[model samples]
Target: MNAPAPPPAPRPAKPLFPEEPAERHTLSVTVDNEAGVLGRIVGLFSARGYNIESLTVADVSPDHAVSRITIVTTGPRRVIDQIHAQLERLVPVHSVTDLTEAGPHVERELALVKVAGTGEKRVEALRLADIFRARPVDTTTSSFIFEVSGSTSKVDQFIALMREVGLVEVARTGVAAMARGKDPA
Candidate 1:
């Protein structure tokens, strides 16, 4: 007697990573300021093996119950769209905007660079900082703290240049971005 064929093995779940062209995008997410919400958002990115280039979060509303998160990542355009869609579906996320795809967006980052040097090296550091328009937030005989705000690429370039002079420490505030025009996201 021919036994009834067992049901075909269930297909494996599809991978979260999609096959698509690599592209850079900035996403602005509005979410409830509740415990574990940030963890869930980050977990979604990590579980899928996606890379986050920069991430920043802050409470923007007067009520302090809502937070805005800005995340920069690189992936295929299709993948980015899928990520946005998935993020939108999250329970805590109130809105998700792909600032890269959104028209006329502005992004900025702030970095505090510390250079420790003596004599000529210190002089050169100051000279270079002046060229970059980095203000001296603090100063000592052997070190200078420079505060610079600009695009990520600009901050990277500044850091690279400072390395040659005597970069001792660095702290960066990840990307903060918003769409242009009167419309609020």
Candidate 2:
């Protein structure tokens, strides 16, 4: 019993890939504009332990027969491909396009910002909103609701500045995206 034959050495952990960075992806999915379609798609992501950073869905086709669902997510490349494959298999999904890799797409979000203040603070808020190209949608003596639409970064910066002036609340529509070319996504 030479010290219990010296216990076997602990094995080093081996990763599938040594240094694969997690990447953010924007996916555009076309599906039938029918009831329960969104729920099913969301369920698939949840069941697989994947998170949806931002999602927006709306009817796109004039007849209201089709809807486009834009989803922003983060994962390794392999995972993103898997998401695409799985989405294609869904009964309601007609197409799943990875817009992030599809080249030349525009992404935007709309936010309604409400700030409460009077006097100089209120004036500052309005001035800052104008700088951001945001318009006052609703206003009163004490508060104002400004409508801002732009890239996610622009909206975020404007909101941060508004906080100093008197940010009371924020309501944002999740990212909406579309390919740049004349062809559909």
Candidate 3:
């Protein structure tokens, strides 16, 4: 019978990076289309030292009373939860969605890549663009502007390849993501 079975051995604390590698998530926030509101949202991230890989904002309402912001970031599950909680607390925010956890979603970005070259370089660039399904939006004898829309990784790969060919400038539309199926977010 036990000399009062000495208190069971204390449990050890759990390790931080437990199993899975950190995951990247996309968040869509709906907020009032008022001045400084964007700043506040960004400030929240900055103040907390969180990194935003991509951010895109647009007024979606016809009345211009509401704006939608899509943000992409990477972190642990717990950290992502914290970000959602904080975003919900913002006064101007009407809704916050963690697309990664909110079921199926579709994410895409548009990029305008400019490359400058001549002869074989230019021809090769066009060939590569065609392979990537990128369309030439502008063209001159010495340069071309290609418009491409796809996943972030696709855009990144295209840009990297373009750099090797002769990347001059690049403008990306960040990321625009939305939940799939009948549900709306």
The candidate that achieves the highest lDDT relative to the unseen native structure = 3
Clashing pairs in 2: none
Comparing 1 and 2 on lDDT, the stronger one: 2
lDDT of each: 0.92, 0.93, 0.94
Give the backbone clash total of model 3: 0
- Residue 169's C-alpha lDDT in candidate 1? 89
Stretches of model 2 off by over 4 angstroms after superposition:
1-18
After TM-score superposition, the amount by which residue 50's alpha carbon in candidate 3 deviates from its true location, in angstroms, is 0.8
lDDT of 3: 0.94
lDDT tens digits by residue: candidate 2, 1-185? 44657778999989665577789899999999999999999999999867799999999998999999999999888888889999999998999999999999999999999999999999999999999999999989999999999988899999999999999999999899999989987
Give the candidate order by descending lDDT: 3, 2, 1
Q: Model 1 lDDT vs. the true structure?
A: 0.92
Model 1: how far is 52 from its true place, Å? 0.4
Model 1 alpha-carbon miss at residue 100, Å: 0.5
List TM-scores for all candidates, in order: 0.88, 0.90, 0.88
